[model samples]
Target chain A: MLVELEDVSKRYQLGNLWVDALRGINLTIERGEFLAVKGPSGSGKSTLLNILSALDHCDSGSVEIEGINLSALNEHQCSLFRRRHIGIVFQSFNLIPVLTALENVIYPLTLSGTVNAKARAEKALEAVGLEQLMSQRPTQLSGGQMQRVAIARAIVSQPNLILADEPTANLDSVTSESIMSLMKQLNREQGVTFVIATHDNYVTGLASRVITVRDGELVEDEPSPPFTLQEAIA
Target chain B: MGLGWKVALLNIMRNGRRSLITLAAIVFGCTSLIVFGGFVQSMYDGMRESMIRSQLGHIQIYANGYNQYGKAEPEKYLIPDRDLSTISQLIESESNALVVAPRLNFNGLLSDGKQSIAITGIGIDAEKEVMLSSAIRIVDGEDLFPEDIEAAHLGEGLFNALDVQVGDYLTLLASTQDGAINAVDVQVMGVISTGVKALDDRLLRVNLPLAQELLYTSDITRMVVLLDETQLTDTAISTLVSAFEQHHLDLELKSWEELAGYYHQVVGLFNGVFEFITVIVLIIVALSISNTMLMAVMERTRELGTIRAMGGTPRQVVSLILLESVFLGLIGSLLGLLMGALAAKGITYAEWMMPRPPGSTQDYPIRVFVVPDILFRTFLLGFAISLVSSLYPAVKASRLPVVKALRFT
Candidate 1:
């Protein structure tokens, strides 16, 4: 198993009441799995993604990624662990406004102290079909182009797992289909695990497994029909 | 530039208005310090030179026991005429020595035949006085003749009070060395201005022979030695003192610095005020820089969160913020130095005349002098203060939690 979560419980204080963001959830994800977490707004999908990526902590449970317990690591150690092993994509496409697309892609590689980071970032951008826009800043790029740069940044370091929180929420139907296909292609070819928390049906249809969440609880974890570029192009 | 510095430079340009405001504060602070320091240093130079040329030469050689008992009994402290030649010869042997003149000080009553007033008289070698007393201004008539014992120079204020003119014969009376009352009549050849009011009111100058004739004495008070450069003062003093000791002569020496107590007091006073102003300027700069960094940290919350999630260490985050502030300081200080140097040149080229200081009677042209040491110090001060100002903000930025920062609206 690449990721194993056992009896994770999390609660948040909202105004004066305790809102359970995650309650006694248990799940496991194997290597090379393309999983989509489907949920409504405020259904703990983001919270679960945060915990899985080591961006946040669980109140009570064991989160083991690649046989390493995350709770035992401090914040600094978690940061190092994430830099070396985990990649994340945000719905807002958080590319540093001051940096060019190529620089943004190289940012992860730089953090991991990768040698020849420029060549690696260039390859990643070319793989995302952004070779023409590599020198452009975020403000100069379209929403779809920005999301492509974000994805390039995520996979440039070749992390074992990529957690995307609504990676295509801001793109149109066409761009969303293209982003979903690109992510699924990376997963299939590179054997990189993906756990994406999203609400779109197009994203859900592309996943190999779909996990449904409601009221901060996991309702279903089931296998889905594999998606293909032939169907997306049609 | 590295990635961190590249982003820092971009961030500075992105917030153009805010960065410019901070830059202006730093620039203004730096420029003020350099210009003010330059002006004060020029004043010190001017005052020191004035004091040296007016009454105190680079070094004064007096007989032993003169400082302790010269005022109580002036005759007992006078150097014999033979010893005067020995001191002059020793002074000429030093390469730095320019000229040496002997002075005799006496007090008496002066009469225009209608009114009499008490006066302090100075007897000097009239030809040597012309070479040494650059600070003395001959406002009216001409300087005294080289060996004309009949000629005299009276201070402007004293001349005005006596109602005397050049060529007028004035009777000066004093007690002779034998305790007998003696008097002589002299021609007032010129009127002089010393700029100092207290000295101008009672001073009179006459040839040395006339003073000896009236007092019936061949003794001199002290020998004044001028040097080629004021910086050679300590060397000249040490050489002269050692020479006197080797020769077994009973003589003592005083440098211009020791004789001019008022100059030291003025320097001390200005130093205190300058230090206080420096503290105020630094505080203003620190607050401005600190506020700029804090606002930057606030606006970039989501950006910072994204970087942290990408595995930026806390140390890296802190370094990025500090780098931005240091860049501001370095650029701002350099600009300030340029501006200050240009302004100093303009002011100096204009030769602007400043009003006389307190107790002074003449106006002098202003000059701004910039020293290299002061320039380096000001740059370091500004840069160091800027780094200190950013310390707290950088630490706060690095300590922010990743999840909340990422979710910050």
Candidate 2:
């Protein structure tokens, strides 16, 4: 009951022609569930994640998060949603290049008038096993370590939901496996729900539930992948 | 505020060379202004001191009918009110007044029998003159001694030009009221030099009574009163003017500033030129800062988009950009003030020998005076220009759409 999308539609203006990105989609997600959104490049998976993250909007639908109807919210309210409730991780690891790991983790804390943000940032970095790497700038950290720092930044505010778009797309298989395990462990321990859009089978294989998207429509909402990471390890 | 300043400091360091170049322009403008301003102040001080010494004793008390055109035809221009001792006593009451030296002027000819030079004579009380004009007055001969009213002090230029030595009896030729030419021989006791070239060329000095007799007018011509120069400020001029007016006589009073109106006019012209040049340099500096801010806004488009996505209103974004520019101005001002102050310090040690004053023979001592207010004003003005220059870029940055800015790559 944490999120509900009722008949969402989205379109784009390409020069003079109108292209439909997503048409008539309805979906719902409950608390503490790991949902993997799967599709190919043009299947509107990224657009759905964007709308859910409040980074973009649905043209005609009600997208609800924590009982708040996002369709009724204005741009400023959408920004507040991004700041107060939703955390995002991107494929390119959008860590500010100038800041060290600790400062990057605390960057979101500065967005709001908060108390004791330094202590909270330290705790988040510690949870990500990056307490020793807090002083290292993004360029100095390895790919897996950089992704860990981005996840730490995402979790620093203790938001109710995490939306990640192609979070493992830039990593190798081994590093990708480790990032997945870290994110899963944080989600389980903290009770924060997650929605991930990905083209990688390995990432979907690790999800508890899988929704297959094709041409902007949900084709299958299955309980689990046929081959999970747990079965692969066994 | 403190955390915001830290961000500003880091960005300034990150863009090191451009900020330094901007700061250098400010420093250049401010240093030239302070140094040139110092020169003007030095000239004004030198000119004022020389005029007080050689002529225009702080105030001149003239008799009735004497002030009209040139004291023209000295025969008719005379002070009929002849209470010199009592009036001198009356002026000595004001705490700011000093040296009540009375004077009489005459037109005559100086001759050593073989050579003759037409000259103007100024008679002074050798006992009361403060020897302020020593640069022009004779140093090689006896002073304008109190007892020697019959003796004349020849100007150095005339003494050199006429080939006359001290102790030579000079014949002064004049015309009487009956239209007959009369001649008298006067002994030369001193060689006088007024630092000014024009005054030194034809001036002769004598005792007051001697000048009165030579001019054939027995009335006291005028009383020249000297004031304590340090106390003779702008406000004191009007105070003394009204006080002298209370004396109930046909007297004329003027301050030293009034005596040098032409010099002030020249200073005004220089000030006008300096201001025009300073404004041009400032405009160049301001433009350079604006260009930097524009580049900064362009570079940080993605960052601004991120901040905007995180609940930063357009007002907040504009404020951030403007704040950065204000911070830039503040930094430039700090650097400029330090460099300008150091330049001002260096200027103070330089000594210059300028041309002799206009009416005196003395070559003045010229030194730079670093006015504190001018430095402060330069810093403030530079800071303000920097802030004004950033307004356009700040607006452009704020008006950028959040989504469009994010896609700016």
Instruction: Please give each candidate's TM-score.
Output: 0.93, 0.77
The sequence of per-residue lDDT tens digits that candidate 2 reaches over residues B1-409 is 4434445565566678877776676667667667666666766665566667767677766664566753556555555536676667667775366677878776667887777889877777777764534335564578877788688777777778886678878888765333456676678888866565676788887877776566565666667777776356455456645665787655555566666675587678778887887788788888888888888789878777766655455666677777777777777777777766676667666556667645556665567667777778777887888878888888888777665676577
Q: Model 1: what TM-score?
A: 0.93
After TM-score superposition, what is the CA distance of residue A119 in candidate 1 from its true location, in Å? 1.1
State each model's CA lDDT, in order: 0.89, 0.74
For A1-234, candidate 2 gives per-residue lDDT tens digits of: 888999898998889998777888888887777889998887888888878877678899789989888887776677778788888887777776667898777777776656787789899899988999999988999888899998888888888889888889999999999999888777677877889999888888778788988888888898753223444564
**TM-score, model 1, chain B versus true chain B:** 0.94
A35-140 per-residue lDDT for model 1 (tens digits): 9999999999999999998988999999999999999989889889889889999999989999999999988777667899999999999988999999999999
Pairs of colliding residues, candidate 2: B136-B193, B194-B361, B195-B360, B195-B361, B195-B362, B196-B360, B196-B361
DockQ score of each predicted structure, in the order shown: 0.76, 0.28
